[model samples]
Target: MRTALDVHISEVGPRDGLQSVKATMPTADKCRWIDALAAAGLREIEVGSFVPAKLLPQMADVAAVVRHALTLTVSHPGLRVMALVPNRRGAWAALTAGVHKLTLPVSASEAHSLANVRKTSAQMVEELRSVVALRNEVAPGVPVEVGLSTAFGCTLQGAVAEDDVIRLALACVEAGVDEVGLSDTTGMAHPAQVRRLFTRLRAELGSHAGAAHMHNTRGLGLANCLAAFDAGVRSFDSSLGGLGGCPYAPGASGNVVTEDLVFMFEAMGVSTGIDLQQLFAAREPLKAGLPGEPVYGMTPEAGLPRGWRA
Candidate 1:
């Protein structure tokens, strides 16, 4: 359990980061990267998504990656492996592979929901119910987390209604999901909106409210994360080197950079259980995994503030 002063950074680079890029990371390299991330003290990681190989070749080897991540848990007892699932089938496959948690993305915007998953928000809630039921039968101990993407806004639709987001979140919770997370999928979220929505979510879902998945598209990723933290959100999802973007939303930037976010928290005297130097060192395996791919991070480029200590 994390205290109020303790912030949990869930690394989504391997899963969310790789999916956006064209090149497919070798299965062995993916495992090495994940191991490096764990060694750097990232206790929770989204290793991969269980989508079809035909639809996303980048995640075709997700099962193999999950097996490797499970093995890492043997050495790193505090490590928690998480995978993304699109539906009940994916959820079953992820559970069989022994992930500690499964995150199902439910779009708050109806247009984005249809475009991304070919289902409406209401239909996604029904799917969540079925997925939860399947989890109860197969892996009763495994948790299911629903990420309400486009909760702030969507590209397909101009503005997503806050009422709609709240209602959909309530519906997902009623459908028996263990937790509900908010995602700025299109990178249109502002700090004030992040704080407001998170406060409302916590009020309605209580402890079941999950992580904040913010994007750096508009350069407010860190600011929005701080707003969410102020509103009682302890868990945050970010990518190493800022390597992720939504395929459904055109022109959206990658997720918030993990190294920068860690620096922000550690500088503010918040403990993330992650070492700055080791965390930056983990970027080596990531670069090796995806040769020629561009990775972004202010902390890595600026070499940490002068005379700074973590």
Candidate 2:
């Protein structure tokens, strides 16, 4: 299948990727990695989270990391600096840091939401109401993104109903989200499921939604990404060297590999505007950031094959 579409890949290595690993990337090194990725032409990058330092030591300096990322001069110039906020407090911290975008992780699976974040679906939406209220009051210009995690299935619960995910997505948007996106938190998403859910998501949210965040834990990340793109999703959430996963979910692989997703799109005659070579060039600083961290990705390990072009 072929279509004329442009895809924007967002790197989540600094936040999602780093948080998965036990070792913390030095604050400075993390900025360098983010800079390298930006140089590679990635438009949006989720720098880190605004969660408590004691709970997530790796992200103890997330605010500092986001500030550093915002300082970089990327190709887009006004890069999208994204951070995850677990609650209203985190949302306040993220806004104070001047982040370009703030995303909240709202699990669609009821059981997963309660177990992972200790908040039921309704409670999470309520938190969004407060986060949205704060953003409207202090930074009305800043956009809030609700990443509907476990939209396809859950680790604790077997299968996540598509209806349930869609309902929560609608609720989040109604609560005051500028946009909404779906995440395959457990990597149980199939390409068909990706297409179906994202198609429904767009139908519900209209022109107010974005990318698909897929995990490679089950090796379907890239395939699922293609499905979402086919379903009208342009932006995507990926991590450098595939170095991320939910700290709570064990089998979920890191975000889909950035290089791999970019390669797939670029190879299929789709323009991502991201240079494959420069994208891989980012690996050095990424490795330098968190030494001993196991960065995952097929493109990084195999290197771009002969005659590849972006």
Candidate 3:
């Protein structure tokens, strides 16, 4: 995936974006949105999470959505259908659905971990090990990625130490996850902190270092992403229209906008293998699914610069 594109943009709007909003997008509309995204040249998309319907009604039809997205692989051969799995049970469900990849969110902050998953960081690592065992048995080839949320800092527990983030990442790597990525769960990360953590993560974890998932809450999302790229990150996680936040995370809102991020890279002459105009077009279904919902982005709203070519 990285070889063809200068940077890998893993669109997480379907899974991360819809889960935060109050409105539960209809299943058919979700498929239509995913179809639009794939047609826009997004090679990897997190279709949905496998959590219980009672917990997140927005994702109740995740299995069906994944099935629909899989059909697109026939036309977009490089498209990778992915899902977020909170635990072993969710992982089993995602594996059974034949998803191409799995992402597990593990918080570095103990307070956030307990509230989000009802488990401490250590307990979550153990949980990940169990999930890895299941994946090895049922789907050995499938990659399991862990997103270390709150790696920057936490609203509940202020000042998450840099050592704690690295320690947790190493623990997850030891637990058998294919990759470990840092997330600004509360959007508290600055460029310097982002650069430091990712630099250390790559030095220690090497090839296991993964995508940079930054939030735009403090308006530092793009800057932090640039810092991560400077620190040697090639893969990134973004939401179309800046649609994301953690319901469990109070005061946290907004993910890095896909349109703006692509524009930033393409303008710098770095290829993302995505069409800028087509990406803006994908937002139509998103708005159609959730009428009156406010979507955020500078590039799409401003339109491409005059005489611009991508």
Candidates' lDDT values, in order? 0.93, 0.86, 0.96
Scored against the true structure, residue 92 in model 3 reaches a CA lDDT of 96
Best-fitting candidate, scored by TM-score: 3
Model 3, span 215-264: residue lDDT tens: 99999999999999999999999999999999888999989999999999
lDDT of 1 by residue, 3-79 (tens): 44389999999999999999999998999899899998899999999999998999999999999899997888878
**Candidate 3 Cα lDDT to native:** 0.96
CA lDDT, candidate 2, residue 185: 90
Cα misplacement distance, residue 3 of candidate 1 (Å) = 5.6
Pairs that clash in candidate 3: none
Ranking by TM-score: 3, 1, 2
User: What would the per-residue lDDT of candidate 2 be over residues 1-310, giving only the tens digit for each residue?
Assistant: 0123377777888888888888888888888888888888877888999988888999898878877887784445757898999999999999999998899989998888887789999999999999999999999999898889899898888898898888888899889888889999989999998999899989989977766999988889999999999999988988889888887765777778888898888879888878888988899998887777776778777888787653
- Candidate number with the higher TM-score (1 or 2): 1
| TM-scores, one per candidate | 0.98, 0.95, 0.99
Give the per-residue Cα lDDT of candidate 1 at 154. Answer: 92
